[model samples]
Target: MAAAAHQADRPATGGQGCRAMTGGDRDGAPGDFRLTRRQLCALPGSAALLGLLGGCAFAARADAPPLPSDLFGGTTADPYLLALRAYIWGYPLVRAAQVRQNTTLPADPFRPRPPSAAGAAINRLGHAAELATPLMKQGVAPNNDTLYSLAWLDMREGPFVLEMPDFGDRYYTVQFGQADSSTEQALGQRTHGGQLPPVLIQGPDQQVALPAGMVGVRSRQRYMMIAERSLVRTPADLPAVHALQRAMRLRRWVDYAAGTDLPAPVSDQRPLLAPDTRCPAPLHFLEMLGNVLRDWRPDAGEARLISGLRPLGLAAGRGFRLEALSQAGRAAAARGLADAEAAVRAKTFTLGRNVNGWSVNYGGSVFGEDHLLRAAVAMDQIYVLPAEEALYPNARSDGGGQPLDGRNRYVLRFGAGDLPPVDAFWSITMYFARGLMVPNAAGIYSIGDRTGGLVRNADGGIDIMIQQEPPAAPRSVNWLPAPPEPFMVMMRLYRPRAPVRSGHWKPPAIQKIGGA
Candidate 1:
């Protein structure tokens, strides 16, 4: 509600800064000056005077002021902001719709809120969506887009259950939101073999909600969702209303490239809620600020504002500057950015993973016939090499390579025999370090079995080039552009066999070739 309210009050400037222009005519040069040769000869002594007047006149022109610039000096900041806002508002609807289409939930109820665990899970998911926005924008990987449509099905009314359908591999886990007092209790029984059940985890009676914070595992191969929780109700009534609250607030984390290393942890404190249910005014203002970044065109002033971000410590790498922000300002911006990135990342990753899994059930009808999903699903499994393994040559065959430098070429080679075990086909796709499509001369971001014209090496060994520059003619076919900075990759396996599914068929580690 606070987020919505803030969005309403401070309509996004759409990236137009406070100093933006309101189109007007330029002031012409002064009318009194003369420059004829005869006049010049007669007024030699007055030349200095004319030059001064000319300078003043030029400075006085209406359009003489310099245009503003963006923090990274990029011109597309305005459009990027707009895209971000659209992503934030549109993500939830997309996820909810997907769940409705794929899962077998009973018809929507009048109130629709289920039990306490159900509600809490939904709310947690929603908060995760909010936190994911910025991370997604920065190119965090598969988790970036997957959270959009992913949901934790809570069947807690009778036998407590939580189902995460798209978790990689046939891998699924269920958990109890509350602890069981007795091992013999049905609540202690696993709904699905090896899976935990959902339980009612009660918070303090005086607590209204969780303060803005982060959650989820931070891994290149894992999807994450972080957010803030502020809804408050009596502990006794929590179970009754939890489901509805979660349904209304569910969100996902999204990352465009790979997940980021975790930031330093903040103290864990419950956020206080206003007496009224409405969000506070400062939050509204922040939302408006976000809107301005998204909707308004980047004018000179807007550019200046973006450019000032780094100095103000509000830009990427300057997150530490958050400490300097007013408590309220810091809380609002940090929470907002985190939520946005997380939501987008979760949606993207869920989609990518599912798409790769060839789970026709989850692919929306739109992609039912598309080759992309088929190609994604055909691949057996994607292995994410640990940073150390990826950097060192002898750490692990699955992880051997030099440390990943922001700039350098890397090679991930898979022998035909080592190909992922899959009943269908498979391919490897590459995204930018930021997780979006990379800008390559060939416009090809990924390579897979579905790649129609690929020419493989004679040795039955396929070498995929991961670097900033295009490979030589022969190797170019396997080249996947790396971001000018650090990035991540996901290898998908479709219809994976027991070997691939059971970890017997691990992916080869990405090896560093030459200096970046």
Candidate 2:
């Protein structure tokens, strides 16, 4: 597997560049770095007409057909098989579009494209977890300890290099993935040290002659992403982290060879991508799957499952026209998708072992190759840090095993020295069903150790107030406000310590205090 092969050959310098590479398959591509940082891949304001997979943009081909009737079989009524095929194959594209529209675009329709505000949703310097912010308004349950910055990249334009500055002892990472949300690379903390090495994304089967101070990690897709994460300790910690984010740059291949200043950002003017974030139906959903398959290189493990897709007008690089299918095939597709959704939901919950009420999951998630699990995750988030970098414990009920609700008050107390074990920081975020944040009076959605003014118990333990209304004045500072309905909470242990990693420190359950 490419992931495993990369792992074995990866340099372990902790982040400093070429210092770890022993001239890893150099292509010595000339004029590799000459473009301005901003011009790395300037996209226009439009979403994709059809998300052509494998670097094939829809409009570029002048032969795109109009939406057809009856995707599989014009006469069939059952769509179980077609539906299932769309659900699994189009999972990443649909998931990516979902997050982009919810987080960045407000006016766009249920089609695909780059979001408005010149990617306003990307690179937000977050404040403490207590207060609700714009990013929070998008309904993401993000951890409080890290300021997240994200942007889509077009690696096919040419190979590019990722450059990040040393953040001293702070924990940070740049997770990259293909258009389908498959794992591309996770370069930070675990890979290199503070002196960040220029990570390379080379051309197809092309060797990257990394410039001095650079290392190589090839990206399989021309269109990829950079999800930046930098740790934040307190409100005062934001500025420095933002600066580091600003310094983070991705330079084009030709620009790197210029040896001088690179040219300014120049847009390909190709319609910038706006992902279609719509409810998956039969025809439209299959259209999405067809496009994504153009780029996603299904490995041997996935080849068989995907092979089943080709018979249904889902072959990669082939144009999909719903009208082509017969009625029977389309009906089966629909039924398949609906059934897949239900099946995936049930399977997702069963994942990882449940320790106490919280799931102590270590692997088989966002970064893995499980198509079904990947679909479920896409229904959630496209990017997720590996367990070693961060561990998540989600609770839907109280310590006594009662479903949590805004109508009830509760407490999640930590015994002295028993707070979530983490080498960096820890936090607890509240989410309405489906992982969205519910608005509250306090303008707060989460809380953590770094939140200012949290009052501690006499024994050095901490008492967190959870409810819709504000708690009494004394305990208000530790309050994690909830919506006026059912809700769930997720505990984040960043850079989890040995104890937590080994499951020695299970997160204390949420103890119900009844309604106020």
List candidate 1 segments past 4 Å from native.
Answer: 1-406
- Among these predictions, the greatest TM-score belongs to 2
* Model 2 stretches with alpha carbons more than 4 Å out: 1-79, 97-139, 260-281, 348-351, 364-369
lDDT by residue (40-132, candidate 1, tens digit) is 334323343233223222112222111123223443323333223322432232222222211212232122221111111222332222212
The TM-scores of all predictions, comma-separated, are 0.31, 0.73
Candidate 2 residue-wise lDDT at 472: 82
Q: Candidate 2 on 1-516: residue-level lDDT in tens?
A: 010001111111111121111101111011121222233123221121111111211112222122123332233223455455456546555555434333333353223322211132222211122223424323335444566655555455556666688878887777765556555466787677566787776755667666677777665654555666677776687678767867777666667666544632422312112245231233455654555565556566456655555556666555355655677776666546444544444444434557666655565234454566565454433355566666777776677666677788888888898888787778888766334455666667678867888899999999998887788888889899876655667787767878887888888888788874
Global CA lDDT computed for model 2: 0.53
| Candidate 2 lDDT score at position 169 | 82
Candidate models: Cα lDDT each: 0.30, 0.53
Error at 414, model 2, angstroms: 1.6
